[model samples]
Target: MRSFVRAGYNLRKKTGKWELKVRPDKDSMLGRGLLSEKEYHDPVRVFRKAFKEYRPEQFLEFLAEAVHFSLGPFNHAPEGNLIGPYLHLVKMIDAAWLIVERASAEK
Candidate 1:
């Protein structure tokens, strides 16, 4: 959850608190008011949707954010998305874990 928020893939927050940082754009379903509040803020749900849709780029974007943090000078804005090492560090598990149910259902 921390990693996802820090990555700002589709959400962000401060002080480890779950808050909405929605930036509705015409390109997103959220902009069309298609996603419920739970769907928009739940990291697992969001990641699952992206993964199931074969959008690996979404993961890359998350990875790029981590890379940007580690290598300060490495700008990811020009690059394209996370599915491996980084996600493991954050979750301490394999990338495949992302597609499965979270350990605890409650956030």
Candidate 2:
């Protein structure tokens, strides 16, 4: 759950009734650096809460959006260190697979 990319990525996605808003500027190097000084909100909590409330199809959509928001910038940005994020990404995918497997077994 903790990774340099997750910690250094500061852009927040705002989901409004029918719209999603993002401010790329907030994810700048300086902005991300400041996060080290304060508490950073982990988006996994948002997804976890949504999973409990959303229907299966709705949860899929929400999950897709979450992955895109979390990984898109990390993938496209230039980075000197990729090992940490790469490992974290693999772990995240494995965790998602486990969730799917457990859910499928219950049905």
Off by over 4 Å in 1: 1-35, 38-47, 54-61, 68-70, 74-77, 81-107
Per-residue alpha-carbon lDDT of model 2 for 2-85, expressed as tens digits?
332232222223222211134334445443322221111233333333334433343334445556667756555432334433
Candidate 1: tens digits of C-alpha lDDT, residues 1-107: 44543344332221223223554353355332333455444434444444444334545566567656777665445333244434433432222232233333234
Kindly provide the TM-score of model 2 when superposed on the true structure, using C-alpha atoms. Answer: 0.29
Off by over 4 Å in 2: 1-78
Q: Report every candidate's CA lDDT.
A: 0.40, 0.36
Clash totals, every prediction: 4, 0
TM agreement with the true structure for every prediction: 0.25, 0.29
Error of 2 at 58 (Å): 26
Model 1 scores worst on lDDT over the 10 consecutive residues at 11-20
